[model samples]
Target: MDSFSGSSRGGFAPRGGRGARGRGGRAPFLTKTRETNPDLEKHPLGCLIKEFGSPDLGLNPVDLAKISDCQYVASYNWLNDEVPTIVIPGKPPQWTPLQEPQRLKEDSGQYFRDPNAAMYPDYPMAPVVNAVLETDSEFDAARTDVFACGSTLGNLLRFARGIDKAFRFNVVVIGDTVFFMRKDNDPREVIKDVRGFGHTFPEAYTTWEHSVKGSETHQRIIRYKFGGFSCLVRFESDGYIPDSSAVTNTTPANTAVGQGDLFQAFQGATISQQPTINKLGSLKIKQGGSPVPQKSIFDLKTRSGKYKKDIDMSDILPQLWINQIPNFIVAYHDGRGLFEDIRVRDVSDDVQAWVTDNSDGIRRFATLLDKIVDIARSNSDKLLEVYCPGKEHLEVREQYGDGAHALPADLRDGLDGSKDGDGGDISDGDEYYDSDEYGFDNRSDDSSEELDYTACSAHDCGYCGKCTY
Candidate 1:
């Protein structure tokens, strides 16, 4: 991160561009930067935070090669306000029955125990237990989330992988559920979003580091996410684990939906429920399926057959995002500021040179965002409490008693520059796991594999939304 010779200070640039005085003088939440393009709609990490690093380096097409080597990662942010009943089906206190846990043989030679027995509060009125009874969101009492090992993040290893991989931003899983707020055409608002993200997923996440007796101990776990979110996933030659609900290699029809892409993010929600989609009738499956009931948001003249507009998405660039797994823990963040965390296994003057040598725009930029995001994730924990709307569900939180907060010790120690038992030295240098191992690439090697975007039937007009062939 030290490689940049200019402007790489703090979280934002001190002067130049945008906030000249009034207007709140630089948004307290956004990291500001210099930009020329006016039509960027929106980029995942906010706007391009300042020219990546001076024109001396020249501009590179936003070629997503950097994240290609990304092995595993995740994004976390806390949302305030009640859990938003509109998103939950049937409004209040609606509970879905739990699924039966499957019995599996364990090397321990013991039958797999049901988690409902080990984790749920035995007390009938336990806060969490009570809250569940009052909230509309459904859950399988035996399984709180899809990823069960706890922390979805596991110590991963990547040797030398591939080169030509493309990079991605956040993995967004679109859903079928919608916040049915109104009965007619009207502006909709969002209090919280329900984007589900997935990766190999940790069974659970633990703040305390513990060693298992003659076994692989874990501290984190990931559950199946419900909306447009992301989770880290990796492919191993020795074994394969699919991230989506569909079977792997056996169902190409569902491959796109199951491949951890943005569309798949909508696991439980649907576009058909959106006012725009519901009115257009584009919400239903295209190839042909069981006929579905029709819906609408308003009694507009258009719905009265007064207007007609044809749209095509057959050719938009198809994208999927994956997080860069922490190869070597270098720094971390707390609510107050950024800290250091590193292990002693890889260190020394030579290592310092190696780190200093690779310093550039890419590394510097990623490191800064890393600190900023870590801080956000840390603070979010406070905002992410037991979400129970209405007085009846308050007991759920009371029972849970507000879960605790703790960051990874090794990661934190590595970020604290002066702390000793802090695991490793932060000043030594930044070390990414296996340079060639992380990053993304087009999913297929065959030139014949076309982009999944919808193409307009119009001639030579390319990707324009509407063009006649």
Candidate 2:
């Protein structure tokens, strides 16, 4: 056995590919940018660096989403990254955490979590919150029950594509995560760790805060709160510095915590003719967390009987109105120059062709919504109430139907008794009363008497009075 130091010593057969035995041995991973992250000129004039060079991962139906998330995070960190500086001695770090936990929790809508890294406040990336659930399998729903992995993404992106152009993001999901950092490892110092993936995000971004400074107005008060907040969702597939510890994620503190944020982000974006970016940052604590409860898909499939996969397409609301912040910003950027616009890169002709051939917002959104309604409706609470806007897009209506069949059929197809007999369509109530009396106008004789069905659909006579329209 031989022991080697840097210059003259050598022993433990340095393991690696053929290149490792060469005079220059490549480091496993770089602690410094120059150590391992080679400068690949991906952008013009060396403007951009290949922050992540991992071989492309498959964006199968289940993993299609993180593609853009990873790309965005990688691009975001590429800006203003001069060689990092190592700090010694010590000084305090500063951050502007939200006063309210709810608001703070919401700031990062979608995010990545790296579990194998060192844990400390001085870590140079967003500390992974330890309440989210990591995805496991596509074959099971619990694998994605609000888990935000493939199924949710499959359904979400499929539908998002259907969202009008004004609502589509220049959403570039890359395949990695990164964190802003300085070389230091002391907890008493400041932590500017905004971790995520890909390279589309600028070194900074603008974040909106609630303000009421002007007269009688809740106008958007904008300032460069931090150039980074304006970046897109950060991912972890790209290399992160020194890696961060696992995050502790949580499900809705309460089920009542409806997907309102999700829905509103989508709906509002569409209405405003904008792109919705509800950047959700979820992190699951690998070793510590409340046991994630799971609904038995077996019971649900059983209850559905032969209709297990027989989806009631009508259960999907015709238009979910997924208004999100990104949608609005994109829209605003186009029309009013409010948000920065991402340069559309040229995709391969094949990818372009695929996008052109299969791109359909209306159909995509409709199909995915149907799937979500079904998956979410499988709640053991057979009486769960799902709702949507009615005819006017103003009034909310409540219905007593199967949740899984939320949109099994169109609500508009069947006519109620009221509008039919008025020279419109046949009325069930009218036919019952028309037997010996003027249907619907008989007034109140015996209020307690049960209406007889003898004069049902088939018993109608030429006496048009008892007959339906």
Candidate 3:
């Protein structure tokens, strides 16, 4: 990857006459609809335990090493349609340097919506599985320990460090891999209305400089080893910088399908004219994008310059560490909307420093993940819920009611250990909640103390509710 170039002044370059087009025009805001998963609310909490204690700073820190460099396993972009249309291997928006200060519109419409479910309602993890199978024929799902999205892992990290308020997610042991599915009150619930330029600034600053024009969101999957567990992490990428030296235009080798077969499969593939729902409930795969190198990919943010506050690298490092994003761009705007102080930084070193500094928290996070996986595997049903009812402790209980499966039946059958019998009952030493009601309010009586959910973004903050942006 090329080193960062010094800052320069210029007007936003027009993207016309580009070889390929992208989802063009201002990005569309999410709207209210019935696309939310109904089963999310039907999940009744089962068992609760408080075995895992808080991070013990007195203990020596453990090493957290990246066994494998972050690789782009798969990507897709959300298109504006009555029914969601996602183009696989979707191109991320390109960073277009700004030459002149520009006034952008404040964000409007729904503040939060789970694009993963909205795009692939039948099986949200279908894209990740498909991409892995396509790119690597020898991919062993049974050998992998954890498959999760950045948000799910981020929530766990916050819980391990005792920094986040409260959250809940589903844990299903499919095959040998334990899948962590993020659960919100409503999959498409509007947390609140947008208030800042966090959305609009990106629309004005970045260009989807490829055939995937008009894409609303871009999601990517990566694989790595952490804490003795192989993890396949899916995350929403903000965009990528075009760097020929760091990025490859060819698809990964798929030995099972024949060398270059996946590339041939995607050749000339365009966005579907209509929603292409396959048997697995995934959208039709398309072949127009190059696999962006992790080095060229970046995370972006926008903040107010009125206070002249410096963006805290610490607050953002945890997120970048989870995604392994190498580049970071933070644009500062005066309260109104004129962005002038735009900083494009290479945060690879900063992230490493954060890992060393937060080793205790990371060790605890790894242990928490191992405990959850054990609890899920111990249950005969192989379905469990991880609920954190505040900064206190986390509960791992059997999933009850009409809880949904993580993936479709056929895909589950393909996994190596999917049919494994229940290991045994969870240990008797585990604790349980005696309360009849499983409900807990996450809000505070003082409105001022309430978190601004709108400030959270799937890519930058994973909707952790801690970001001031």
Q: What is the lDDT of candidate 2?
A: 0.16
lDDT of 2 by residue, 73-111 (tens): 011111000111111100101011111122101011111
For residues 1-469, could you state the per-residue lDDT of candidate 3 as single tens digits? Answer: 2222111000010111222121211122111111222243555576554344454323323654333545566666655433444555656776654444556656543433455654565567765665555455455787678899877897778777777455677888876678988776654333343355555566555555435644556778888878677888887776766652332222111111322332322221111122222232225444444466788787766666666655445556777788888877767677777777776667777777777788777877877776777777777365677887656766776666667678766556545533323421111211111112212222211102222222233222222111211
Provide TM-scores for the models: 0.18, 0.17, 0.72
Considering every candidate listed, which one attains the maximal TM-score? 3
Error of 2 at 410 (Å): 32
In Å, residue 85's CA in model 2 sits off its true spot by 34
Q: Candidate 3 versus the native: TM-score?
A: 0.72
Candidate 1: tens digits of C-alpha lDDT, residues 37-86:
21213321232222221222322223421333212121111011121100
Arranged by TM-score, best first: 3, 1, 2
Instruction: Let me know the TM-score candidate 2 reaches against the reference structure.
Output: 0.17
Q: Quick one: RMSD of model 3?
A: 14.2
